[model samples]
Target: MEKVLFKIAKQWIAGDTVDDALIAAKSAYSLRRHAIINKLGEYHTSKKQIKVVLEEYQKIVNSFRKWKIRGAISIKPTQIGLSISQKECNRNFEKIIQKARNAHVFVWLDMESSEHTDETIEIYHTFFSKYERLGIALQANLKRTDNDLNDLIGMGAKIRLVKGAYREKANIAFKTKKDVDNNFIKLMKILFKKGNEFAIASHDTKIIQKAQSLSKKYPRKFEFQFLKGIREEFKSDLVKKKFVVSEYIPYGVNWLPYSIRRIKERKRNILLLGSSLIQSHRV
Candidate 1:
């Protein structure tokens, strides 16, 4: 049953190995779409587990250089033991960052829930001066993101702007979709004015259209980013319009939990899984 569910989940996950992720990324590259590869796992408790995760990322960096793949890597803070100790997490991050820097591949620090925001930012700041290829993601839905963006912009940081995914309290996040969208645009405009480079990571047509319109006015280098398998047609359309685009591809044995969280965040994903199961049964 797990294997069956995994088959349905593959619409979102690339596969269970680094090789699977590379294959998916290469396919995207052929279509002029870049990728952000993430190994699926987070909130590990033990140092041993964290070390294993670090080694997997090291292998991924090596593969990126070996294949000359046009993409970067994204990692969650907890996956590397940020919850265990900030200092330990920093040590783990440095190892991966050094490998990425040596291979000339970019590393993106993925923002988790609101709780880890400050520490994640601190970690990013610690290495920002040392590695120009490192970037961090920001959750636009957070009430504090505007100030965070301002601070990052002052440092000329590259950011990947995303709508907050993890569930958070009403006091800390914008509850409605409209508010999140408005804040995202607001932050995006600020980035265009002051940020060095950033990614507009959203699938909303209205948001993408707003960014497209803003491009005419602000005219900064930015790319559109979408999750794998969610909006292929729209992504291709963006490519046709000559906008840079990238797919966020995740793969690993931990896909089940990741897929569950995604489904909880967006209930429509349940329908997507149901459709996948039906199609597979027919096949």
Candidate 2:
């Protein structure tokens, strides 16, 4: 049933075209909700496909400026031709960062698998050294992330901290919910103290509880970010408390992979809520 729901969720996906992503972004912006639009395809099969992806991104960036919208667009390194070459990836990112500056927008680099963490950080650093409008993601579940935060802190980097999605080796990532939550809290303190621009990207009640308490400590520096279809109630509660709330707006017809990941991730979210994870993904 979960798989079936995911199969049907493809309709909720924005579309395969650049125009579809723009329409969805406009709607999200109109709701007084900021979006993080992303092209749905990943792991490009050829450089040509990657070029197509970059051109599409250029279109999205341009549309955001032309439409006078305020939001962000997130990109997976692999989707932007990362698998082919890191040098090329860095070049592509540099170009986009420049374009993003003209639009008065930010570009968030989405975290991928465990193997790509170091390279991703390096890519971010290389550009962040020159670009200020760009932000990067960090997953709390990784063992080395605490130290990674230390390095990023020295640079005063902006971050969106998530509980991580990619399945990783036991040595590199904790499998238990308790361990992951504990690590997330520990890292949360570091980000809060660094006084860096940050977002709490998780749906765990316990994590939200921690952020609620922590928000009193920072006043307005921290925000709670959740995916569009998950954890609907907390957004209002946080805004009422005067803490910022950001929703991740993922749009793309190739939602099959993202939907599948959401289903597997539901198992973890359900564990957090002490409820069943199943949901009908009616389109």
Candidate 3:
């Protein structure tokens, strides 16, 4: 059953090894799109577990240079050590950044639940000052994201704006697709006005079209990001038009949780993915 499930999940998941991720990245490169590789799992409480995760990230960063791929690594804070202690997480992230810096690789800090937002931003700020190759993901669903985006832009921080997959209370997050999409566009306008070197990470065609329209007015240094298997045709079209595109890749044995989160993220994700799956079959 597990094998059967993995076969279906592999549409989006790379596989259960770093080699699998590298293969996916190489393929993305062939299509003229960069890759952002992430290992699945988060909220780790044990130091031993954290160390293993940290070392694996270090290994991934080291491999990027040897593979000759133009891409970055996205990491969940808790997967490293945020669940254990902020100090430990910072130490581990610094170690990875040092290695990545030497290799000229970019590092992205993925935003988790609202509970870790403040600390993750703090960590991103600390390292970003010393290392310009670092970027952080921001959730557009949060009510506080507009303020957060403005503050980070003032700091000249590189950001990847995501539509936030974690569930949250109605008070802190926009609960409906209409509301979240509104907030996404609201924050996107701010990025075009004053932000640069950011990522417009979404699969919504309307949001993507809005970005294209805004780029014409502002001409900022930004790029579009989509998951590994989603929107392949659109991604190819964007690349052909000379727009920057990136494919987010994840690989690990812990695929079940991530797959569930995708379904729970938004109703639109389900429809979009369903359409993609059907289109894939037709091809």
Candidate 4:
């Protein structure tokens, strides 16, 4: 059973090395889609492990320059040092930003569960002031996101809107798919109206269509982001239409949790997986 599962997981996860990730990014470039590479471990309690992850990320930053790929890296705060102390996390993150700035690569902060939301946003605010190429992901499932989106837009912060994957209390997050989708649409409307240089990161066909319609109306600077291997055909179609698309490619040895989360995030994800498998063969 584990082997079978890993087979499917491989379709989503790039591989367990920096070179594997670079190959994935190169593939994205060949498809005429941008790449957002991520190393898939997080919530580190050990400073040693965190330091290793941070250094790995710096290597990824430099590697991006060496490969000359128009790509970015998405990092979880906890993976750096957020699980230890905010001061440590801030120090480590600043190191990454400085290196990334020199390499001319973009950095994205991946929002974790609700417990880390405030600190993550604080980190984004602190760094975004110094780094214009930084962006942060905002979860639409959270009730507070409406206000948060407004505030981030006012700060001219680049944002990536996602229907969040983490589970939370009903009071904290919308529990039903309909409610979540509705909130996602509402937040996306706000992005089109007020935000600039943002990303609509969703694999839902309806949500992608809605973003297309909103772009026609508001004409904001934005791009569509889909997970690598999940919607190859759809992404190609959008690329053919001249829409900017990015593939979020995650690579690491810690692939099980991320793979399971992709399936368990919502019931529709299972259906989407099947659709992707079929569409992938066609593509």
Q: Which is the leading candidate under TM-score?
A: 4
User: How high is the lDDT of residue 10 in model 3?
Assistant: 79
Tens-digit lDDT track of model 1 for 1-283: 7787676678878988889999999888988999899999989988898888899888888887567678899999999989889988998899999999888888999999999999999999999899998889999889999999999989989999998778989999998878988999999888877878999988777888988998888888899998877766678889999999999999998888787667666565566456545654665
Clash count, predicted structure 4: 0
Model 2, global lDDT? 0.75
Cα error of candidate 2 at position 205, Å: 1.8
Cα error of candidate 2 at position 101, Å: 1.4
Candidate 4 residue-wise lDDT, 34-67, digit = tens: 9999999988889889888888888989987678
122 Cα displacement, candidate 1 (Å): 0.1
Number of backbone collisions per candidate:
0, 0, 0, 0
- Candidate closest to the true structure, highest lDDT: 4
Residue 75 displacement (Å), model 1: 0.9
Q: Which candidate order results from sorting by TM-score in descending order? A: 4, 3, 1, 2
- How would you encode candidate 2's per-residue C-alpha lDDT over 1-283 as one tens digit per residue? 7567654454345666777667766765675556677787777758888888788777788887787667788899998778888987887777788878887777899999888999999899888877777788998889999999888878988888898877789998888878988999998888877747888898888888987877668664666777754554576667666666666766665677776776575476534322212332232
Q: What is the C-alpha RMSD of each candidate to the true structure, in Å?
A: 2.8, 3.3, 1.5, 1.2
**Candidate 3 clash pair list:** none
Residue 3 local lDDT, model 4? 90
Model 3: lowest-lDDT 10 consecutive positions: 1-10
Write down the lDDT that model 3 would get.
0.90
Model 1, total clashes: 0
Clash pairs, model 1 backbone: none
State how far residue 62 of model 2 sits from its true place (Å). 1.4
